[model samples]
Target chain A: MKMTKLAALAAATMLAGMPAAWAEGVKVGMITTLSGGGAGLGIDARDGFMLAVKLAGRDDLDVVIEDDQRKPEIAVQLADKMIQSEKVDVLTGIIWSNLAMAVVPAAVAQGKFYLSVNAAPSALAGKGCNPNYFSVSYQNDNLHEAAGAYLAKAGFKKPFILAPNYPAGKDSLTGMKRFYTGELAGEVYTKLGQTDYAAEIAQIRASGADSVFFFLPGGMGISFMKQYADSGVNLPVVGPAFSFDQGILGAVGQAALGVKNTSQWSKDIDNAANKAFVDGFQAEYGRLPSLYAAQGFDTANLLISAMNKADVKDADAFRAALKEADFPSVRGKFSFASNNHPIQDIYVREVVMEGDVITNKIVDTAMTDHANAYVDACKM
Target chain B: MSALLLIEQILNGLQSGVMLFLMAAGLTLVFGVMGLINLAHGSLYMVGAFAAAGAAAATGSFVVALVAALAAAAAAGALIEMLVIRRLYERDHLDQVLATFALILILSEGTRWLFGSFPLYLDVPDWLSGSVTLPGGIQYPLYRLAIIVVGLAVAAGLFGLISRTRLGIRIRAGEADREMIAALGVDISKLYTMVFALGAALAGLAGALVGAIQSVQVGMGEPVLILAFVVIVIGGIGSIKGAFIGALLVGLTETLGGVLLPQLFGLFMDPSAATTVGASLASMAIYILMAVVLIWRPSGLFGVRA
Candidate 1:
């Protein structure tokens, strides 16, 4: 009788372990600028994605994260490791455009889904748009296009444009000029990743232009705004999403006030989802959420929503679901285009001192469901 | 460009130059007096900014923050000298470089661990927050003007101390002949520590002052540090006066080149082409300046050939 009882217990234990052993865990890998000058944005993106993943509570999915250190080589290495060794099904979270260009093609070659949380270069939006590639964030041109729309409406007769001398910077100018039908007074390009802007500002003051447009992101943006304010140039300065985000407001401070820009979502957006995300983020990180964080949060949720649609079993089906635009975005009613980039309303915002913090409040809607002019160039 | 615009550009150059001087002064002093090359100098600058930001946030007084910045940087410098730097003093420049580079990694990571990878903001004093009118109808930032004043004052103080005081005499003597000073019964270690502290204090002051205008955060000092390196290289390492001049030259060249080059190119080419070529070349201007200086004066403008 004792032997019979032992056999029965062993059989039951085996029965319970069979299904557990058969379950395959899905792997997702993320690489980001987790150190150096751009670390703040990368950290925000990381946190937002993590929060979404935690909220989803997926038993079958496991996520791995790595710091690219803002180096394309390092990002590429991480991508290779994720694809070859880790066998990750999805790769995401790129903050620098150069780094994104390096990693995205690698993921595409492997037939893995790529979700970009930030760094929307126009090349990816237009000529290089891939079926496996999707930008959960705005196109590099979207915000600039919005600025252009605002400039057109403002009836600025002659405008001077400025940007860092790089591919994305050129795209910003091209994006702006597309919508803005004004006399081009002049244009100046500062060095990419430049820390000083006095000379450029001096030239701008001298140019006799009616207004100025610029697209500088991260540290470059902060430093330029400070110097521009210092130079006391009376011409109104304008740019896009990154130029006046919460990530840099503290440094720019009062200098940022009266500066207008374009963005899809601001901290002051009157939406329940955004309100909850902002409050929760501040409570967790002790700062306001930038657009980077909003997109990061949305990216994770969108991924989860697509996974649910495809039941996490079919990668092709999941990609199709993601491309179908079936998620409620924190930014009021948004969707993805056929090219896998966002199609949404972009708002013109002016930086103002709101209570203890500096934030952007929506002044007007600049563009709606705006397909980029370069869309025809994209075969997709 | 109009004459007014040129004048405005010059002022901008001056502002950039002064900021560079603030960084170079401390670095040059440390190298000259201590006979030690410190790669972690930038780390101290970062520490000072972080210290100031923390203190200012807590007390809501910029004055206290400035004081705390000095104290924190000095304490950190003295501690480093006592623990790590003292060991590397007898080592070669390569060893010193490697050790200090390691210190940068440790300090940067430690700062991030403490600050949690977010930038802290430092507010300019209400009194120094606006723009002041310049001679050419140019309004420059008041905070920047204050930086110029502080930098000049420090330069004056340093010169006075080196020429007029006993401690300065000892420091100069030690720099010339360390063994002789020790043979004469001077507490050489104490003197070295004091010099180190003094250099650290200058760096701290710079960090604290600049923090008000920029974000006070981890890795903030690296850019300034690189510029300082360029300054000392052009000025001749170990020469304070040379450092000041070299810094000014670099600052002006960078600022003015950024503005003038594009326009100059614009005169010949289309706006897009001019902007691209001009901006790229302008960014390279200072490095080119350094190379030219090195070609003419291999030992640096003020460097005494060993």
Candidate 2:
């Protein structure tokens, strides 16, 4: 009787483990900036992605996460590990453009699908486009262009523009210029990662500009906003969503109030899908989701939707299924452009106090069905 | 630019110089007396910022925050010295480097675990919140001017402590010959601990002071740490006076270069191209200045030949 009971227990354990082994379910490797200066952005993305996967209630799926530490070399090494050792079917989650540039091209070349939650560099959108690469996030310049359009519509003249002296910084200014018709009063490029902006603030005060457009991200943005507020430079301030995201808004505090920014997503986006996501995310993480978090959630849902249609082992079918973009997106209506970047409306958001908590509220739509400048360059 | 703008720029340079001196002074003293290359000094700066931010949030008093920063950093320095760093003093520079680098990773991760990833807020006190006008009709933040004044006062106090006190004599003696000082009945270990704590306190004070203007977050110390090392190298390693002069030079060069380089380039090129070129050059100016100083004096401006 004892032997029979032990055999039954063994059989039950084997039955429980058998399906996961037989299905050969999808394995995903996520590499993101998880520690150091801009860690808040990456942490939010990671939490959002994990929350979506948990909500799916699938036990067969296996996900591996690694911290890139915001370094391109480290990201490359992690990508190699994920591809060669872990044998992940899909790779995603890089926050910085430089790291994305390093990891995405090489990972996609190895025939693994790369879904970008953030860091949509123009290079990959255009000449470097690949069939396996899809960006759920906006192209790096999309929101900046929207801001430019908003400024133009608002009749703001004599704008001063500034960004860090790097590729993305230059890209941001160029994107703004693409839509803004007014002559810039002054254009300055501060040092990347510069903490002190007193000299630059003095310049801005001296320059007779009526408005300021800046693209300083992460800690640089925090420092700039604080100093700008203290400097009493009361001219209207505008920026892309990078600086004004939900994660850093508290750190910016009262300094960011009334500032106008542009993004493809906001918590107050009036849609059922968005309401569910915003409510569910806050319930799960105990914090409001940032734009990066929204992108991450969408990326996870996109993968899950494709997996329902085709097995990742069938690469062609899987790729086609992903391009279909059949999943419900939090952004209301999201479709993939020919280049695999999102073609959706971008909105202007104002930083406002929502009962002692600093957050963004959607004011107006900046652009509808906006496409990137590099789409024409994409052969895929 | 107008003369008033240039004057304001100069003041900005001075303010930056004073802050850099606060960091460089402690670093130079530590290297000078201990002959220990502490790559983890930046971690202490981070600790100070975190402590100050936490204290200020809890107490709502800037004075309490300042005290907490110094005490936390000094205690942390002493504890680290007792546990990990003491074992490393007799080791070679390579081992020291590897150990301290490990400490940086451990401390950064530990801080993250305790504080989470978000940056903390540190506001300037209400009394120091606004700007004051100068003689040239230039507006400068009063808090920044306070930083300049406080930093200079600390420099003076440090100078007096090192040159005119009994503890200062013992420190100099230890620097000159550790064994001889020990033989003269000084508790060398205790003295070492005190000196390390003092240096750490100075670094913490600098971090806490600067935390008001900058985001008080993990990894905030690293950029300042690198600049501080450059200042010490330019001023001559192990020389406080050298660190001060070097820091001022770097600060002035960095601030002025950002303003002037583009204007200078505009003379020969288009305004857009000139701005781009000038900004790039200005970023490189401080390192270039350091390289020039090294070429002129390989041991640095005040460094003694080994």
Candidate 3:
């Protein structure tokens, strides 16, 4: 009985030692991909967000994170857990479109402010856009549309379209077609997570097209590029920012060289804001920054600015302040449109090799105030 | 739709078939020799890529990186066999699978811990960096051609070693009858370790070679591992020949389906809708092929009849 009493007293003493405000710290829950094939994106978002929190040194804010494991169902469940059990005031960090779609609606329904750090699904940008939700990233269609517009300006007469079979893939094709008024030799759709591209490459080779446009990210992109190069197909490859980002550039190597894509930011961008971001990220993480990292960094700034705007003495005020456009972003000057998506410029970039580095260099600006066509379709 | 396109697609199919063979070879050998279904086999592939990246970074030599990757993967497999796998060897398949599944979790997390949850890049060697022209005016990647050559060479070497070498004979004996082999003075545990190491080395080599062509990050191997399992299942778990054929079939069907299905749909439907339907169907094609094969040959093609 004496030992039990001593143990209880010890526990009480330890609890008392912690700052009283630690208990009242603004609780923000973050969910991102943490395992399986899509883990790289999740890891970056999670680590970047935590790093931002540390850099801010705001001990007044507490963060709880969950790994969604790339499943939409798991994401929904985790969002509920963060809201009800953890009692977090805000939610952030969704890397995939499906998971974002699944979790955002739930967060908005609960009137909890959702600050999306990554995914920019067009549905969320336009009509399906929510007042309670805000994006720190560009709309999903912006980059793809930028690629289409750039290719059209390049005067590529015959273009071939290819992407994985999914909603995002469809959006990419639609986004590209919106700007490129060329004779599409063909539009080919491949399986999501596919690793081979021989048949498609062969088809493209024989089709006599001038260029091939595809939207294969991750392992799928690597496999296809390798096969395309191996088959000796001479057509230049074109893609959206994601199809050949820093995440998989190493894997694609020389195959990705000379490929053109549209993007928001690249490590090679020469602006002062970009140089600081690139140098700081490399010094801290020992590698180049992906667009995901840029987006994550932007999210941190957005959230803090909102906090200052609403003078977040309480969680409710913090939520309301974030809903009001309150942040100065590194991606030029940007504000949330009526639909809660960022109205910003999309840049068309070209992939090149600089010594050992494989990176994209922005060559042209493609679009501004780029909103998805489906925005009006979404009545919300 | 022209004959030239058809011919080109066939070649594409063949190339894909070969790539799958590389993944399936190690999986089938390990399964055949030791009735263990190592779900973590893919994790080993990932380890190989990281090892290659680390070695190349240190030495500035791609060949050294390749060698180190294979050696490290083999060592890891042997170590794992000694520490965790040997006990499970006598257990049921479900238990073996569960243990290996646990190993995958540990390995993936351990990798993240060491690598700091970031991806590392591997460069293609300068020698094989360019594209080559084929007879049909087809342009092919030199590295890909090298991969095919290397894969075939390894296949030949594996066949020769299994058929002629003393260690291979012992392995064959162990596979045929573990009890008799043990009675004949073979160190069954040592043999198992060597066989497992050999299989791991092959997987490592595949991972290292392919890493240049794909992202080398955590959990990168799981998808490939699943496809390899499917290949071995179709090929007959214990039959290397079956694995080779099974992998090729899957690769060709999947590639061709992605290309042909869209064109077929375009003949009737709008190009946009056709693309959606085609891509969805293409992804399903290989699984459907696997199902059809299983229905026709429950024991798998070339599998020894139970």
Candidate 4:
């Protein structure tokens, strides 16, 4: 143990000597949903992260990517392999909340730094927070809370809401209700992975809601939007950007037109850092970068900033450097909250068709410097 | 709470039931005729949806898309029947299940390789888009009504084919005694292939129809497959009529249970906790129905005892 501590100190000293130079090999293990329903999000995140690393021309950053298949068990297995066998100093790139919940705790407990690209579960933001864990993405509730705040400000009274029945789903509603002051017309939890939303749509229609807020991510959102469109009860649907993200807007087609969603980043954010990142991403990937990509890009740049300031082998120094958050973020106003999740401006974006290509444009700022409700719960 | 809402929810149930029938019909026929438990039937459904999406994108015609789905799923089914599934016929149910499960993984990965991981675009055609007021003054999506019409028509046609056609008689005979039918100079293998392809085409049709509204992606079929299995189990493993009735029952129960249980619980419990509890119970309603049916009949609602 003494020898190991001495070796670690020596390694830290050696790594510390290289200031802003090559930080001597910081291995990043990315276990993300690469081949399943959530693959688009993970792919964009991975590509965005790699793009940042490429743009920075960092030789020390070695990324080992693996597919989690959106299964928690698979994510746990991959995290174990990445931590124990690969000995990666940093872990990142999990899209879904359940997978993040399964992997993050154990990984952080073992003293490896985890930089989250997306999926900020509220538990991690609250009492379960770890100093070693840093989420470049907003808290799980941030976008939902932003949506609720926007709706309340817009005076959408008697709003009906729905979400899938899962941990993230529950969190989404709770977050929305936190800022939403209006009386709920109806609240329903559809089964997770439920493709059929007819019952829910009918309920929404009958409930006499002035607006609808649903947190159905992935194909569930697509189905609900399409079905809601055809149901002839267009009560102004809104949610977080998961449903309206660039990755899936095309599949949703005209159904999502004019629908507002909340996010920390958009393609039309109009900042130097954001414009450069967007242009560079389009040039590199041949597609519009989703918010997931933005999160990933921010995460990589954050790591670069931290590496420039301190050696990764020195835990306290590296943690402080990460907390500094000196990186140029595509979101423009990104900074780590007290619990390491993002404390940033959330923007409301409206889905618009630009020459037959469905995408979103920034409409309004929903919330400014939105720190989560769970920040007080976080002791660390 | 309102009668109109109840009617609309019933309609929703019927629409979902029709889609399940399309899937369960094929599953039942394949299992009944071949004595095969095919866990990979859902993969065939996925293949159908992908084929449809691809064809729709290329041709800009829903008809072409549907035809592509039918042909692709049937062809895939025939190929598997000839190559892999034929060997598993003599094997136990466990072996068949394991083999078909493997087929599901292979087909899903192969689909991802072909189409990439992103969900493909498939929407309801222009003519079928929008809502119509039912006789009871309930507004319902026209596409769902179309699905019901199409499903019932298919069921009628299928029933006619089974009862009237010589092919249907042979299928029934083979199910009764395979070796005996083979000894009686029947082309058993060819018949099996044809039946498998037909069942696959039905699943494919269902996939294409549902894919327009839901998503066209890898692993999309697995969830539907589970529901379809539940449908067949409730309806009776080999009985088409049972599958139809069972599907409708499950769909109605699912839809109504999901909508009503929360409200029912709200009468005695807090609304939020009621919703939480009700949604959980609602998901299990169909499985509970299955269990009750199994206990009552010992072989499903319409299943024949050996």
Candidate 4's DockQ is 0.79
Task: Give a tens-digit lDDT track for model 1, residues A288-317.
Answer: 888888888888888877766674456677
Off by over 4 Å in 2: A1-23
Q: Where is model 3 more than 4 Å wrong at Cα? A: A1-25, A34-36, A47-57, A225-234, A266-287, A311-320, A352-356, A378-380, B2-4
Q: What is the C-alpha RMSD of each candidate to the true structure, in Å?
A: 4.1, 3.4, 6.2, 5.0
Writing each residue's lDDT as its tens digit, candidate 2 over A253-328 gives 7888999999999999888878888999999989999999999999999988888778888899899999999998
Q: Which TM-score value belongs to model 4?
A: 0.96
Please, what are the lDDT tens digits per residue for candidate 1 over residues B72-162?
9888888888888888878899999999899888888888888767667677777877688877567667777787787788788888888
> lDDT values of the candidates?
0.82, 0.90, 0.78, 0.91
**Of candidates 3 and 2, the better by TM-score:** 2
Native RMSD of candidate 1 (Å): 4.1
- Model 2 chain B: lowest-lDDT 10 consecutive positions: B297-306
Tell me the lDDT of model 3 at B190: 92
Higher lDDT: candidate 2 or 3? Answer: 2
Instruction: Note the residue pairs that clash in candidate 4.
Output: none
lDDT of 2 by residue, B108-129 (tens): 8888889889888888888888
* Reference A-B contact fraction recovered by candidate 2: 0.63
DockQ pick, better of 3 and 4: 4
Q: Return the interface RMSD of model 2.
A: 0.9
**Can you tell me which runs of candidate 1 are displaced by over 4 Å?**
A1-25, A267-276, A279-287, A311-313
lDDT sort, best first:
4, 2, 1, 3
Model 2 clash pairs? none
TM-score of 3: 0.89
